[model samples]
Target: MRWRCVTGGLLVVMGLAVVHAALEHDEPIIGVDLDGNLFINTSSSADGHTRRLLLNGVDVLRELTELRQKCAGNVPRTTTTAPSTVAASTAMPVSYTGTVGCQLESVPSNVTHLFGNVSLSFCPLLTAESLKVFNELVYVSGDLKIELNTNLTNVDGLGSITSVGDSFFINSNDALINVAGVGNITSVGGDVDIRYNEALVNVDGLGSITSVGGYLSIFSNPVLDNVDGLRSITDVGGYLSIRANAALTNVDGLGSITIVRGYLGIYGNDALTNVDGLGNITSVEGTLHICSNSQLDTSTVPESVRSLGTCQVITSENCMTC
Candidate 1:
């Protein structure tokens, strides 16, 4: 198979005749960049003519291998497509695909928009100062996940980001106090999950997010006292779950949510006394689960939502009606 070199160390394979054979081998042809990031050229059966350059570590390679096996015989061949022209100027915003691990020292300072997913997980050295490089990033074309960062106190460094094209996940950060840094983000094209942050007190930073195309889950954050920051979210395309947040007293911030396309679950939040914030929700397409919240006043649940769509309404376990 003939190979064409593209910018950013990507190599596009021309022939699809040997694509399955190359994937079947124990060691597929892969490129390793100076920063130790892995790159692979893989055929996309969906389009059948163009191949995509994927960037990630070993885990992504393994996932690609499994995908190749599943779609082995179905791939169709066509004339090889020419590579897109790359701009030589460094001042231009770099567009990329696939997943990128956030390495503080290696991050490109010129990037304003990243076309793929970004993950900042288990990064012990990632402090507020080091995150300043990302202050200029205005958008992410895919998911942005910040998880398990032990030393990070706030995400104020992400102040310039206006939107995420896919999911936004903030999970398991031991020292994170708030997500005020992402306050400028106006929308998410997919799910928004904020869970398991031990020291998190509020989600005031998310006040600007107006819509989520998928689920919205804020779960298991023990010290989370209020979601008043979520005042702007108007729609959720999937389930909306706020569960196990022991210190959450009210959902006053969710007052703007008008529709949830899937289930609405508010379970196990011990201190959640008021759900008056959910007063504006006009529709929930699935089940309504408000269970195990001992101090919740069942009467506060608006009569407009008592029926909760076509599905069952589960209100149980010491929830008193005022």
Candidate 2:
């Protein structure tokens, strides 16, 4: 009988015509080459009523057998190509209405248009390096909310953004120290709320903002000493609230504001001593409420506001209902 076997490697066996006393041991055996295919062949023969065997291709069989024996104790190995990694410049732009988690170590530089809100709220591992992606962005077609990011120290990366299409809420960031990054933004289409930031000490970064389409509130910042960062604000379509800031000493930054279409309330600021900042405000179409500010100079209250009489401007702690 004769047969051939081909596999990842080659093997051959021959001769069943004569008897052989013993196998030879002097020749070097061949090894299975990983780069080549395996070829195996065998032949057999028989005589009437007698059986005899001879090894003709013993070298080929010996080499293949030796290779098989050598590899028996080791585990098989497989080859495969590696998966590709994402690069910041080639990533596609996307809109997110709900939270979107990103595992990439870099942010895309070409992103434009925020079809929906972009919130990085409560992201514990987010650092300024990851936010560098916003450095080139000039406009956000939706809300730009960055709050509760414990490690965020400053928003300087967002320096190029000129406007936000919706409300701008930056609150409750434990380690936030500055927002100088968004200083160039001239207007906000919705409410502007900046409160509860524990380490926030200044508003100097917000120097260029001139108007807010909705209410503007800055409250509960424990160490904030002044509202000077809001120096350029000229109009607020809704309420203007500056309250509960423990270290606040004055509203000196609001000197440029000329109108408040809604109510104006400045209360609960323990260290506030004056409203001298409101000197340029010519109109408040709605009621004004100024109370609980222990150190303000009642004399400094704007006459344009006190003349309304419909408003309350109480400086005394024991003052009765307005």
132-191 per-residue lDDT for model 1 (tens digits) = 888788999999999988888988889999999999999999999999999999999999
TM-score of candidate 2 versus the correct structure, residues matched by position: 0.66
Q: List the residue pairs that clash in candidate 1.
A: none
Per-residue C-alpha lDDT of model 2 across residues 1-322, encoded as one tens digit per residue: 2434444543444446442423233222323468886432222222223122234524334555566765554436688978669545754544323322333233356454445666778888877777777766677877878888898888887888888888888899888888887888988999899999999999888788888899999999999999999999899888899989999999999898888888788888989988888778777877777888888767778776675424665563533355
Candidate 2 runs further than 4 Å off:
1-107, 308-310, 318-322
TM-score of each: 0.68, 0.66
**Which regions of candidate 1 are displaced past 4 Å?**
1-98, 318-322
Judged by lDDT against the true structure, how good is candidate 2?
0.74
**Native-vs-model 1 lDDT?**
0.80
For candidate 2, the 10 contiguous residues with the lowest summed lDDT are 44-53
